[model samples]
Target: MIAIRSSVAQLALLFLAAAGNGALFVIILRLRFVMEQHLKWLEQTYPAGHVSARGEQWYNRPFLVRSLFQFMLFLAAFLSLILLIATAWTHRGEVFGTMPQDPALTYYEEHAARLADGYETLSLETAHPALLKLIDEHFEGETLAILDVGAGTGRDASWFAAHGHRIVAVEPSEAMQTIGKHLHPSPDIEWRLDSLPELADTSASGETFDLIVLSAVWMHVKPDDRQQALETLVSLLKPGGRIYLTLRIGPSEPERGIYRVSEEALNTQLAELSLEAKKLDEQSDLLGRSNIHWVSIGICAATD
Candidate 1:
């Protein structure tokens, strides 16, 4: 089927993109090492009488090759980025620029909310127990209106719906959202098409929630912008509301080791951002690969 082919192609593209980035990164690292070696060689050769007279000169330098290689690396970087972006767009359904904003994210692909049969809540028996504990601590026995941001396929949202809580699931990725509708339907939940950043924007323009769930989403944010995002979330939550999110500590995520900012650090940052972390738990994931843990925070909108 065409759907199968598209899936395969998208996965292939992602693989190629990852390979290209790795290759490019290696090339850049090698070049930097070579440059450092070259500088050392020059310093020793020119100043220490290690080379013949005539200034041991520029004509003997291999700067042209370095320039050519640098140009090639830059070109490859540009092309690889283009390919990665293209592949992401091709595979990810209903994308809107950097963040997806298509209506497919709001409902099931078949356009019906009756297929939700597998939306059951598993106990402390998850591949990741921290998630369940966090959910229980925050949403347990509370009749609060909850918003599950980036609710992939409605697993968590569905669970909340099955319980007594009211939920509005929001997801931006069409593929995931479509699956979610099939998993968590009416008489249980209401799904929406949106992302956290966009939802916060909606909140700023006058939308709100008693509790917001952000699991495994913060790690995607670039290092420079995450703090501002935390502040924005603080602004959106209700007076007594809370945010339950995971913070993966350690060296696994080399790209944006941003969350390496420990829970204590997070607590301090939350304080500055006008949010109070009522309680936080240090727990790991299923794999226990990187020793990751989560910090659950609560907020009220004022400095005083």
Candidate 2:
């Protein structure tokens, strides 16, 4: 009797899960169909000549090719839905409500050695010249207290420390921090494990800095967290302090889970935070990635 009850309960759960998946599948299929029909309508409405030169090519695909594309898209979507449902049911407890794994942390932890070696090989000579120049102009003092947020491998932190500045290198990944400490063993540079939207640990210490550098780090910050992050960083800035941000603009790095960022979007976020933008410079990707570009901005903590 107990065995029969257990089997019945399992069947009920499966049925419930299937029911949920059925609704989702139908919704997804409808959306796909609507999008396809809309695109087809647009093609017919505009015709080839009316379409822009760039868009004309898209509409010029052979009928068979277009049909094949649609079929492939539908098949992909169907398989994705099945996989999502199966995976969720297999790990329901962990997937339904638990926090998602952070890809950046995972990447750093898994590739710590390789990343450290890469950082070691990189020369400060290739550093963004505009950032360096702006730091020099704004920070007139001989020695400044600097905060290197997301200081992976401590490359920039070591550079700042070597230049006679007190450095606080904030890195959240233990593996990355370990490599950084090993590579840049400097008394002037202190390594701390803290992350943003909120630098809770770093903020608890009540320490502020004259200069804060977030190089290749701002892209990791999500859209919703931008304002809070700006506020937190602003609060940690000393009077007349400056911030240097270097953001990568392009598609996300799939492995690292870094998001694409734009200068205009960042400028808007900064304006909302009341931070004064001192400079915004655009540069080609330093690593020779043709699709990627860099935007460096210098901001000041608003003084009221």
**Top candidate, metric TM-score:** 2
| TM-score quality measure for candidate 2 | 0.65
The candidate scoring highest on lDDT is: 2
lDDT of 1 by residue, 1-304 (tens): 3343555566567567667765876787697798778867887878674443333456555555445666676677667667767766664653323434323333333333442333233332363355556557656767777777767667778767777778877765566777767655766577776654446444645656777777556655455666776766766677667676666565444422233445676676677776666454555544444555555444444442
Q: Each candidate: RMSD to true structure? A: 19.6, 22.1
What's the lDDT of the predicted structure labeled candidate 1?
0.59
Any residue pairs clashing in model 2, and if so which? none
Q: All candidates' TM-scores? A: 0.52, 0.65
lDDT of 2 by residue, 106-222 (tens): 677678898777667766657668767877787665589899999999988988899899999999888999888888899999989899989998899999998888988888887
CA deviation > 4 Å runs, candidate 1: 1-142, 198-201, 252-261, 288-304
